[model samples]
Target: MSISIIRLGIDFGLVVLIWMIQLIVYPSFLHYTTTNLAGWHRKYTPLIGYIVGPLMLGQLGIAIYQVSTDFTFYHSLSILIIAAIWIITFLQFVPIHNNISKGRVSESMLMSLVRKNWSRTILWTLIFLSSAVQFF
Candidate 1:
């Protein structure tokens, strides 16, 4: 199969995943009590990581390969956006998830999670759209 097709599939998976996270998963945290949320978060993070980790790695690996092989505008932009998403995930979301798992969650924090996640949602959507345009 073509690399562009593979890249589009990965990007599509991520865009769907991010929308689910943004619209459904994160917001649902607000409904739980602090203790329940913490307990659930502990389990949820690892479970979700299983799905997220491979997709992210595939996306990143494909992005790197595309850029290194072709060095086109689309590949370069895709890699830069992927890099930003990685930075945001580690630098911003990881600490928040850690705190939540440790029972340090507050309403504000939950709200912040939903709020901050918009950036990722938009970025992933853009990646998918760009991939689609390139593929089609």
Candidate 2:
């Protein structure tokens, strides 16, 4: 398959994944007691990373390739947005996840995860839709 197709798939996958995490998984963190929360989060983090890490890396690689080659508006924007997502993931979300995994599962923190995640969720959705426009 073509690189563009692969990138679209990555974007689409992330859109779905982030939505689920934002709406379902993060909220569900609240259900776990504080004692169990850390262990559950620690386990969930690595497993989710196994899924999310590759897709995220793939998307970044694809975006970078696209930009380096033709450097079109969409390609450049896609890379910039992907960079933003990565920045948010590492700078913002990762810290929160680290905290959660340390058994610091507060309602406010959970809410923050949900709230901050909207930036990523919306960005990924836009990228997916933009890629779809390119596809069609």
Candidate 3:
């Protein structure tokens, strides 16, 4: 009903969608048999790249800008957590994704990678939730 509730709902929805893609769709598509992998990959990669990725980045940018202007406890903490998550994702997650694509990946490796990067995902989600509170 309120603006804060609407923003919270949107933020939660975005995070949930991303999590579903990373945790379910990606692994399913990767482990799919036949032409399913290619089909799903072609369909989803563009959506993630062109739409979801940019929107998430824009939200992060806004968070950063807001942090710069605010400089309070929660704002600083949220920015740091978000930045850490982004940095870890690019440095750690991307390599794992590349390895899997190159046929050099194992299930254990993928699982381990996900486990290691879980903190990043969790932290980013927290940052999103905390920042969304500012909308209220």
Candidate 4:
């Protein structure tokens, strides 16, 4: 398959995974007890990272590669959007998750995490659709 096809597949997969995490898995965190919350979150972070981290890196790298080669307005715009997602992930989400993993399970923080995560979820959805339009 072509490189664009691969990028689209990766983008679509990440979109689906993030939606699931946002809608289902994260909401479930509210139910865990404080004692188990840390352990649960600790275990959960790495496990989910195992799946998501590579896909994210792949998407970012491919976006950069595409823009580097083509440098079209749309491709560069896509890269900017993808970079924003990475920035949101590292700057906002990771620190939030780190707090949670340390047993700091405030309802406000949990709510913030869920709310902020929508940035990634929505951006990934947009990215996938944009890529589909570009590719198909």
Report the number of the highest-lDDT candidate.
1
What are the runs in model 2 whose C-alpha is more than 4 Å off? none
Predictions in order: lDDT:
0.95, 0.89, 0.63, 0.89
lDDT of 4 by residue, 25-98 (tens): 88888888877888988999999989998998999899889999999987888998998998888899888889
- lDDT tens digits, residue span 1-136, model 3: 7533543564576577667765875556437643444455456555666765765676576567667776789867866776786788789877766655455655677567657756755775786678577767
lDDT of 1 by residue, 28-73 (tens): 9999999999999999999999999999999999999999999999
Model 4: colliding residue pairs? none
Model 2 Cα lDDT, one tens digit per residue, 62-82? 899999998899998998999
Ranking by TM-score: 1, 2, 4, 3
The candidates, ranked best first by lDDT, are 1, 2, 4, 3
Worst 10 residues of 3 by lDDT: 33-42
Which segments of candidate 1 are over 4 A away from where they belong?
Answer: none
Of candidates 2 and 1, the better by lDDT:
1
The lowest-lDDT stretch of 10 consecutive residues in candidate 1 is: 127-136
Model 1: lDDT equals 0.95
lDDT of 3 at 124: 55
| List of clashing residue pairs for candidate 2 | none
RMSD each, Å = 0.5, 0.8, 3.7, 0.9
Winner on lDDT between 2 and 4 is 2
